[model samples]
Target: MNGAPQVQRRRGFIMGFGAGAVAALGVAALIAAIAGDFSGSNLTSQASQVIRDEYFKPVKSSVLNDASVNGIIRELRKRYDDRFSHYLNPHQLRQFESLTSGRFSGVGLTVTGVKRGLRVASVLPRTPAQGAGIKEGDLITAVDGRSLAGVPTEVATARIKGPPWTPIELRLVSGSGGATRNIRLKRASVAVPVAVGEIKRAGTSKVAYVSYATFSQGAHGELSSTLERLDRHGAQGLVLDLRGNGGGLLNEAVLSASLFLAKGQLVVSTDSRTMGHRDYDAIGNPLSQHPTVVLINHDTASAAEILASALEDHHLATIVGTRSFGKGTFQEVIHLAAGGALDLTVGQYFTANGISLANKGIKPDVRAVDDPKTPQDEALRRALAVLAEKMAVENR
Candidate 1:
């Protein structure tokens, strides 16, 4: 998990134990099951009493706002016991939806809460982010005059995504060069820019390139289709360019990696005390049987890590990149006593091979330092070099 609680590198948030683990309904039900009078409002009444007596009365904490209450519950659970909790507010709900399903109109960039304020982790090249002159070391202090200090990451995102062509101004404090400037960008669909291709050289070797510009729901379909086409095109070599990819859906990561793995191999799994342990696997033979390579950088994270780890674990491909954003943790989404939901960290994850690429990203067998203006990839070069060596030995 490169961004704990991130999946567009967005919807990636925190989760907690099961609903039963967090909810009073279970308490109410259990109480009623024993008392034999479990009913609607009565459950709520008893639930409130139980919660009030257990938490509020003890600490004299009186919170009504759903978001605040949820945050407190989560804080308590994470700090103290393993009790389950969640957060639900209008902005939080909207942000959650946008992260998971809401398409935004803006350049895809990863911003995080760091010691030096909000720092830009990486910028997808040639997108609005690059167009706006947004660099990797910029610090986002405010958006539209809203100081991002103490703001939830999701809330910061909702502000970032707006109507296309509508200028959004970002106030920043630079990380390096000690230069501060306001970066303005117009939001647009961060899809279509990413491309996947398979290259076949008669006298040389086959090549497959999956150029990722940003994370999108369409990314999985596109990547899968590209793999299919490469297989059809008789590709013997593969190259996955995650140079600018900011990451996406958690499940998709598993799906993409599974495509190149043997059947019955586990891909990913979650570890939450309340949320029953779950695991994923390759449903079928993923490879048309081609050697592969994955390219990543400081920007690659979350779902990206998931895919990279799977292929590497299975020895299906070699990972080549500078280093990856280390983010690993699972969040639970709980239905609120209100109407919305809660995004809280409930578990952590591991590759089927049992390696947790959480804080430590997948290390390349061959490391390559990315030179932005160079336009040539050293990772691909090393990957090609390795694949060639293997192919040469096979031919002999």
Candidate 2:
């Protein structure tokens, strides 16, 4: 279960500083910032002093180089209590870049952090994790025998991914107390599609079912193509399935929203302290004006939330299923001079109606609970019924 320790070992030299004292000073500064006089500049100055002078560990001049500085900044960001802010070293940065490219080598599982530990949020179909029976809500204790408990989701993800055809073992326990078991899975290159569509023959008309995996750079193009094909197949209505989607690029979200909205419609807007205010407008022709439904669940987040909120606010689609994951903040990746990068949450985004889906997610217009016993999709069935009723009324 042991890999390289998360914390790097101190190699030489002794610094004449007490780590306990410096950590206390940091806490004091944090308290002061909370109490008022909270300038980011002041916080940065205090942090610099603690790292340069107060840290208990010896500070080597050679280690003070860019790479070490980046590492220190990463630790500082964690202390800053901003969960969305992250510093990626060069290797981690490359790994991230690979994810956004729509292809990567991994066990095909997505995870998230919670109070208990790292939990498996979803597993992609036909992947190694799915084949090994990894289920949602399973608490992942360790990767390759190394305990991932208390580790950040990003770090855990890094540990799980590797070159294709490599084997990685995951030790996990059920949501409830159960036997701890390890499952070995071979990592494979996963080429994720942005969106996939199929026409379902429902009574007199066909219902277009489109499921989007992530809002990567190619999302808009994929969405457009799918919509076009569905329309050609005489799809009378649409079910935009976004369950378990964690979301991706902001621009892709806006573009996806544009597929249902008309030109000049505001897709999303942002309110920021550092970057000021900004708005995104739809510029493409809508695929159809027919009745549409958006399927969402608790795992649907970030860019996916943006699109759902926009469509719901505009009364363009009837949202069914459960509440969304409520992640409305957007991050900006700033490349450091040290070949690494910093992803900082710089702003909060709002729907077309100016509603912020931060901690409070968007409520579904039609709440449909999941029915495990039914062979049919409960949410999809409800959505199809709603669309059918709408179409009937329109014909009248």
Candidate 3:
């Protein structure tokens, strides 16, 4: 179950063309001619133009003006291997905004599609799903009397989410051939926690264990406050868990890393033909200098990878678990005047050590894989052991 959706930080402005004085005058004249045209035709033409001129790679002129906006995006995705870029219609834009802001209207159940139906992976605390007695491993066979046997997970998830106070009926079977039951739930706004923290006793040491869920808006503030609160409680070390974290805002990643790294340390850097090169540095005072261990898995990606790589490169934390999900690229959300927006891949980011995490994810210093059959979290236990060793060395 993914707690946070993967999204990139917002850049303040769109890329502007740099032209010679005479060329700039000509471009200005052309802009003046098209500025008054606010029709759908004008919007489509403008979108095509932007994609042609500003995309990371060159696009053929033939694919620019498709009959529909969705058609254009589909062609781009199929032809150019552009998996990240897409056009969000007005409704989708609102949903995206709601998710990035850490709130959404849903039953608060995360499920994965299976042959039978959608398998419930988790039910968020205090949510409608939890109130309705939905449990992990439950097979959701139908929604509103419609069988979801072969439906895609995304489609099923969409059906589960609706306007607040709206009722959703789900038919579910208990794990692996248990009883079947139907329940009606009213969707409500769910506020996902950016970070959940607890202090654990590892041997004689008190280690602060924090599971950072996403890099969404205001995530840095929540993480910083959590760290501060844990630190005040006499925690001696830290175990940062980033498993299943798909990632969110890039700026939030940098700001979250700033809570652990020293001021002026480079967090990440970006490069592209249109956006050029830029470096992000840590800006705030660190909350703790205690020995730290970061837990990662194959699901960690994008901004999560950025933070993990920064800490690893700076020798600030010992990375544990399997390799991360490589997602080195960055995206920019450009809002359109005619509603909706273009979420386009704008550039690629590098870690603090100048390594691109595109197809190559960060390798952990200490590797550990958990066995699902057992209830114990082997990776987390390994992290605690590593943290104990680091703390012992520091005490010496």
Candidate 4:
């Protein structure tokens, strides 16, 4: 989710845009000029609402000389209820910038809020997070001097992140063994990779492992580059890992699925009042012919669900993992006045076959939950077996 929104591009969604704002004010103004009982409290509330909804910033006080108008705008703040209203001032804007860039001055690990606390979901490869040995499932207790019991996930992330070359301390409890560790790191500009590919033998079958960390700004380009490398490295069978990955961009999901499907094939479908489909048939695709198996878990959400559902519906790959995180709503960011932006869930996505997965997530054909400490690699093993059979049939 893009936490910060740009207010200029969303003129369609915000009603304050167009003459409607002025018109709304004009209606109030006309009434103010002729209405009876001008000193009544109810009229005062009504006038204040006019200033808040109709009046813009750096106002010409001479026009809205009514004190009631000013009070309505300031005291009531009813304009914020429009869903398009946003309050992202300069400070909020800066925080959003850091989140989108991916290259933040921090320990370089993506953490999420859970029942346990702020837990380290995945330690980005080759960053200070990895160097500090912050494993997946490590519940963070504190950062610097702040306690991490009730703060927002972003706030906790900001606590651990800072300007380049600054020091930050963290206390953690491991999910694997309940072991505790205290580590201090010098935050730097962490360069997160787009796609991660490793071609190795999985016990007995030769399955290629491809993990996507996040859908960052340049995700499509980065994923294409990674696929090229994997193709060169002799990846005939694929294990596309999507566990613990909260989705990034929407089109990136479509583009990533496009690489593995033929032209004119459906990738993902969207729902408005009616259903609509987005086709993925870009020319000169890379992995469209390869037999791929997607690895998913509970954390797979949004764009991840889109990609998984697309491939399964199109018969491109067999989804193998626990049930997905079940987030099927797509949000559209609308720019608001006052410099902030609004992110509203405007659409719902379906599989390529047009089966909506809004509240219900995509169910894997093969259910597997891989937990090493407890020793259950059910999903992975099933996927490996399927790929092994595929390879055997192809070789024969």
Candidate 5:
């Protein structure tokens, strides 16, 4: 009840229930036993009976024999229509934990599905993906001699990740070319860049431009330090770039908002049947009250949307660019006694104004589209223009 081992034992008992009667009683009878419809069919009794059953012998021999049980769990989620719910195997759980911790063993390319193949969105700095010259916009066609044409993006990404020092071959076509080339690279530990900033001239005045990659652990601390450095260097305004960001931890999202909002200001809230209603407020000191603009696009999601929505709702910053990705549901990672974890959708999140952002993303005040021919971010340029105008008005 208290530890993970206990939870695992409970899960094991549940699965082992009616093992002997499984062939005779079947799944329906098993459910009835669990529901207390049958006499002497309590959980413990049923579990003991199942464990002694001949069909359950393989389960006692190896975890691999639990495949049927795992399949059933997956089918249940599908029947419930919750695509966000996941039953991660041990290996996947390890990969996910690494990702959330800001480091993982992989080629270090952030990718999305495209018409032909998986498109390279961004290559992390100093990683194997970058080292192999896999720049943004490369379309991956195959992995390790396997053709990924028409394969799901999620499956392709899984094939790309593995233990460090392992070799992975990628066949890809350039974003602008017809020729396809194969690149062999060794996977290595890649750190996710959470926050980076620089000061840029906006209308003769210098404004800080900060790009937040994700809301990983300790993200607020990183962002606060970056902004503080910019403030010390005479930053007149700020451009918070949330383009291509896919969001991360929820608490980190609220913490990031705290950096710009007044103490105790409402950031977000959650609505659910089990958890009821919960509100999260900004707790830390305000970092910068300077005229600011937020840059967002279709890839900006979840926690990123939270920050954008909060800033816009509070009239704290001018939002620019396309609508956000609109991922407002929160997930709770429950570690199983087996080996992996369950990422279950817990609840839908709402902005301070009580608007649920589940399917309806945050719409920018000044919509700007990026040009396909140019490498420059047009949305960022528009944000700078908006910030410059605000700064000019404030000075006047």
Candidate 6:
């Protein structure tokens, strides 16, 4: 379990979890059978059965099951000091799958939770939300007839997303102290852009500007193709932006680093208590040799940090912006026998130079911070400036 095969096996496991309650029960029975004594070793399951039979009030089995699994995760976190490990219910698992797959059925708006409701961050083009005239800065106070006040953004988002062609209503307030207006729209399948690219002029140097929202499925391919296209279009330098990316598939991160790095170069190494040590290396030819600068901020984490650290350690790119969000740990989503999954922290990852980014994030070579109140992207400007300097040096 130390190469591409291992990575593929991990990905396959995540995508191939058996469906339905029967599959769950079958796995649970197997575990109990392996223990050879269900009554003693499987106390949690027995307790659940007892609660279903003897509880004073009525309770849904699904609710009880979710609670039991979550309680286990909570105890594990406290006992093992693993803050990142948690359980995802079936609905949450579906959302996670959709997010990593880069598609979801929704009205097509990105929102963050606020005290009163959800704040519309950005509206995707050609989507139902945009068609209905929802704009950035709009406050969504309710979904359908239910008030979204005090609701977490994830929960509110789940409520908004449903089967394609389904109708949904939102009550919105435009700007602060604005009157609320209800808007109704139909949900549609929205393809989230994992990687986006363009060419921007930095001084006389045309730089390929690439931004990754996440290292989801097909992200490396998307980034590779975009960089190739931009290189062909006469981009003299590159600005790789990973400002708010949280990360996704680990293989995607390895493959993405392979895009810029020479074949067989080390990308990252992980040390797991169970999986042991494994090394991931660049596997493909370099996309372009253009002078590069990488942009990172407080939100750049996990796989993004891995890529940035690789390039920085190899002296292939100049890192710009503030320190990245340190997240050196990697998690494995293990499908439970009773539905849902346990996203357990399985290992710690090291950068190309063998540095652990836990708590101590990647420091920018040219630190620049962007003020949210301002319209200008100061950090991006600094990135472009760094790219221009590198291009100048390369041309000399």
Best by TM-score: 2
lDDT of 3 at 370: 72
Could you estimate the TM-score for every candidate?
Answer: 0.70, 0.77, 0.69, 0.68, 0.74, 0.72
lDDT of 3 by residue, 1-396 (tens): 123232221322222344466446645655554454434466667767656765789986644532366677778867866556767666656766754344448887655556577877556789998899787668899989988764433445666777789998999998755899999989998866779999997668998999988898899998988888998999999999988677888889999999888889999999988979999999968886889999988778889999999999999999999998788887788898867777777899999999999867888999998765466988899899989988999899
| Candidate 4 residue lDDT tens string, 258-337 | 77777667776666553354444433364636677888887788788888887788777888888877776666545545
State candidate 5's TM-score.
Answer: 0.74
Model 2, 276-360: lDDT tens digits are 9999999877777778889888878899999898898888888998998888787888988857677777889988998888778
lDDT of 2 at 328: 75
Model 5 agreement with the true structure over 63-142: per-residue lDDT tens digits: 44245445655686568644456666667666566553444478888776544667776788889988898866678988
Candidate 6 backbone overlaps, count: 0
How many clashes show up in model 4? 7
What is each predicted model's overall lDDT from 0 to 1?
Answer: 0.66, 0.76, 0.79, 0.66, 0.78, 0.80
Q: After superposition, how far is residue 351 of candidate 5 from its true place, in Å?
A: 0.9
Candidate 6 wrong stretches, greater than 4 Å: 1-55, 58-62, 79-83, 90-104, 109-160, 165-186, 393-396
1 or 3, greater by TM-score: 1
Clashes of each: 23, 3, 0, 7, 1, 0
Distance from true location, Cα of 218 in model 5, Å: 1.5
**Residue 334 of model 2: what lDDT?**
90
* Runs of candidate 1 exceeding 4 Å displacement: 1-88, 98-104, 108-127, 172-178, 192-195, 198-203, 212-218, 231-234, 244-246, 339-341, 373-380, 393-395
lDDT of 3: 0.79
- Which digits, one per residue and each the tens of the lDDT, describe model 1 over residues 1-396? 323332121123223324444444434544554345335455445545445554434532234345356656667766854322346475567775676465567676766554334678666666788887777767888887777765556666677777677778888776556667787778766644555575744238766666755556566667777777876766766777776465667776766766677777888887878877888887775657666667887667777778787877877777876777766665657676656666666777887777766657777777887444456755567666766776666578
Clashing pairs in 2: 1-145, 1-146, 19-56
Ranking by TM-score: 2, 5, 6, 1, 3, 4
